[model samples]
Target chain A: MTPLLECRSVTKRFGGLAAVDDVSCVVEEGSVTAVIGPNGAGKTTFFNCVSSIYPATSGEVRFEGVDVTRLAPHVVTRLGIARTFQNIRLFRGMSALENVITARHCRTKAGVVASLLRLPSQRREEAESEAIARELLAFVGVAKWADSAAGSLPYGDQRRLEIARALATEPSLLLLDEPAAGMNPRESQDLVELIRRISKRGLTVLLIEHHMKVVMGISTHIVVLDHGVKIADGTPEAVRNDSKVIEAYLGKEDVT
Target chain B: MRDRIVRLLVATLAAFLLALPVASLRGNSSTGFTIVWTPAFVTAAMVLVGGAILFAAVEAQRRGTAFWDARAATDSAVGRRRPCAAQAWTLGVLVATVAALPLLGLPGAWTKLLLETMVFATIAVGLQITIGMAGLLVLGHAAFWAVGAYTFGLLTVHQGWNFWIAFPAAGVAAALTGLVIGLPALRLRGDYLAVVTLGFGEAVRWVIKNEQDVTGGDANLPGNIVPGSFRKPMGALGEWLWQPAAVDGRTFEPGTVQALIDRECYWFALVLLVVCVACVHLLAKSRVGRALFALREDETAAKCMGIDTTRVKLVAFMASALWAGLAGVVPAVHRGSINPEMFDFNTSVLFVAMVVLGGLGSITGSIVGAALLWMLPALLANWFPEVQEYRYLFFGALMAAMMVVRPEGLFGGARRKGAA
Candidate 1:
């Protein structure tokens, strides 16, 4: 079967620096794929290009064989790609539930006039959105904090809230940038289970992970990058033992 | 229960103490305090009472006192029945009280001032949609007001159009101007947006000032903007609607007719204000409204949620302009005059102050803010004429005091915590 999301030799540049340089990857349907590299490896920048937060400088991105390189970030979201930032960006003033509900914007359509009139359809959609938002929060284990401001949430809860918000978009593919960044070991362990559970739900998850244990344990496929170049791609075990992957992580040192 | 009584006594005593000096200062006789109903004294008393009640309520909750248990029990009971049933009931009572004000037999001037307050309330509420909810700081809001007022004034005077015909045209003209201004300004955020809007306001003022042939420039526009269609009081319906009800015995004097018109205009403005409030309340709770909040919070995140940030911002600008535009009809129809000086930068700043004072993102806050600001000035003029000369100085001090006391505004939304 065709991969759910494919990046075709994508390149992103800023001035003289190439943030993402001639990188390519394929995320299989219903698989947890990990992109791992050192700092400035362009993992987050690659995610940005795929999510259309920044348009790719060259080449294309395809979702189920459709070119989406030129689409706006919102349009990309509508086309079933939703992502969280490397740093959490929840609506600070809004409640966690509202943060999730806001992500359901494309899925729900109640314009100003219908809302003003309080049309039956609009009310129904609102109720449904609220219910879904609550459910998503619960799935992320932050349901009890639903009414609390997202900004005021504990760091772990805020990260999970961002995930819940992304999930509210009901995407076919979810991009999580550093899903385990700054997380404690226990939290990272819980996140591994969450990613596994998400994959079991038949949604493709492409995550950037720093924790080697997380990338090795849960991700079915691992893509390794170094200096904005994709150096290794295969099953987790295959990518781990590759000489280049080891070389990228450590120094070359004329490895045999 | 014991704590509640003590709290109530404390509040009452504080109110009395606060009101005493104010009442005594305004007393006609300096030697001995005599009960007098000067505007400033009455205002002082009201403010003190309100402050006392708020303080008591807050303190009671902090102390875990039984002072609120009774009210909370009743509130929960009401809340269980329907989500906003208590609010609906409170609103009904408030409307009934306002409607009964004329029955208390206030002087015509006071009634006229109250009508003017309603007009400003409408404008402040309109401005709230942009600055309060959408998080767009607008210094050019008065330009939209000018568009509405001048459009109505010009149509009724020069074009000989009726108020009924000109009213909607004024709103449309202002909305269009909002759209035009928003298209460019929305591209810039925060301070840059403010600068663009400030320029836009000045541009509108300059156009009216220089285009003397049409606008009448420094001189005011001609009179008779309110339609005469109801002047004869329709046959039966008109007479029933506006009977020119006997006020102080004799009717038909110029002052009497103006007073009667003031009463009629008060009702008109009240109805419009109610409609505007309802519309604002509805819009603020809608999906579009949430989108605006999302846009305000984080534009990039909002866009990632599939919200067209630019579109939402533009709609907020137009919606805000529409409210202010519609409100402009009152001043035009009431005064039958239009001039560039009326829609100055100070007027824009005052409306902004009103929105901030009322509580940003709170509809009721905007109304209360507008009413307090407008009413306080009038009352000061009545009881302390000399202070009126230093009106801006007094307003600046009041604004500073309000900021220190309640930066979120008197009715700021729970979500607007930590908001500047």
Candidate 2:
């Protein structure tokens, strides 16, 4: 099958710095892809360029066979792409249900007037959205906190909640930026399972993380970046064993 | 709540005295100011005292130290959508009072102080969108209000446009202006944003003041924007209200503008108020709203979430400007005029203060702040005309002191500090 998402020679520059330089990768359907790199390796920036959060200094991003390099984030989201932040970004004052339901906005059919009038159809959609949101929150294991304020949820649940929110968009391609950051060992292990379950739901997951263990544990394929350049791409074992990957991570002396 | 109740009783007693018409209907200055404390006020006072004693007794008997439970931290597995009861009550009463104040309108008092409050409340809600939701410090938000007013004023006066047509146009004009303001804001932040907005607001006011041909400057344009439908018939409600006088001209009659102005402004403001509330509420519950909150909480994190922070910022800027514009159109019709001086820096400052006083990103708080700030001056002046002239000074001072003590106003919530 054709890849669900592809990045061809994506490059981004901030002044003299080539943050994401000459990076290329494909996210296939029904696959869990991981992008791992050390700090300042432009892993996140590469994702941003692909998702059109940043206008690439060069290259193109194709989602579902359309060049989405110039598309806005919301537009990208509309084109079956959803994302979660490395650092949790939820509508802090909102309830967990609201957090999830917000993502459902992409799928909502109500016009501005219909929503304003609180029409019966719109109300029905709102109720249905809430129901779906509850289920999604449960799917991510934070159903108990569905009505809880998003900002007040526990850190690990916050991560789960973010994933649930992204899933709310019903996107085919989910971009998770550092989903494992700040997670405990147990939480990280749970996240691996969560990723597995999420992939089984037919979502093409593309994750950016610095966690080596989690990266290797769940990814079907792995891609490594060094200063925005793709250094290696293969199965987790192959990429993990790549000498370039080791050098990209551990400094030269430690890389023997 | 008890403490607030006691405060309310004290305020009520003061309100009753002030609502009494000074100089009397007879215009006899010699009769002096008679203190007419309505019986309803007596009930309120009783509630106040009873509430205070009951609250004290209850707290004394309770095991806990405070009335409220400590809010859960992010590390806590349990998350609860703890509604702030204080805010709920404030909003409930504020809405109820604003809705009812139109009864005073049927009496032909131009700019029913209550109506004015509702109008400003609308403006404050718009201002709240910027300062509260997007965390944009708009020092000159009133300029948007001016833009709305002028748009409506010029169109209705020159083209004889309908109020409904002009209203939306005014709002669009302000929104476009807001988008323009957002451009400079790309290079500004925090205090710098405040300065720029202030400059922009002052510039708008100056433009209006300087463009004497259009705005009429200090002379102010005479704006009498009548709804084309007003002549279309009021149906049962209109007929009932306009019923010919009974006893004499002194008897209650509804046909006069003085009688209808308060009610009209109240309804017009109420509709817009609901629209503003719903918009803010929906925005807070959408991806767009989330982006705004994220921007406010941490722009870096929002960008990392694949949100273009600049785009979200601009969207909020336009939304806020649009609201101010909607609010501005009302007063022109309400006052039957649009004055350049009305859209000044002081008005902008007042808008920012409302959002700050209400908690930032808290829609309910914004509404409460708008209503409270809007009504206080009128209520005070009605109850105590002697102190009315210095009302703003007191309000400004009170707002400052409140910010110093409780930077959050009466109903401030945990702003952008939500489920994340």
User: Could you say which candidate leads in lDDT?
Assistant: 1
Provide a comma-separated list of chain B TM-scores, one per candidate. Answer: 0.76, 0.71
* Clashes by residue pair, model 1: B233-B238
- Writing each residue's lDDT as its tens digit, candidate 2 over B1-420 gives 764454345334433432333212111112322334444433434443444334323432342323331111111111222224543354455455435433422223323544565566667766655676567788888899899988877876667666667778999999999999998797678999988888999999998888887667777674223333332122322222111122232443345533454466667778788778757666554446655655665564454344566776887888888988988877776655668888788778777777766556555456445656665665556558899999878987877776664454544543433323
| Model 1 alpha-carbon drift over 4 Å, by segment | A254-256, B1-83, B223-254, B413-420
Candidate 2 residue-wise lDDT, A1-256, digit = tens: 6688888888899999999888888888988999888788898888777667777988888898999888777678777888888767776666688777766766776654565566788878878988998999989999998866788889989989999988887889988999988988999999999999999998899999878888878889998888778899999989878889887777565434
- Residue B138 C-alpha lDDT in model 1: 96
Clashes of each: 1, 17
* TM-score of each model, in listed order: 0.85, 0.75
| DockQ (Cα-based) for each candidate | 0.53, 0.19
Can you tell me the CAPRI class of model 1? medium
Scored against the true structure, residue B117 in model 1 reaches a CA lDDT of 81
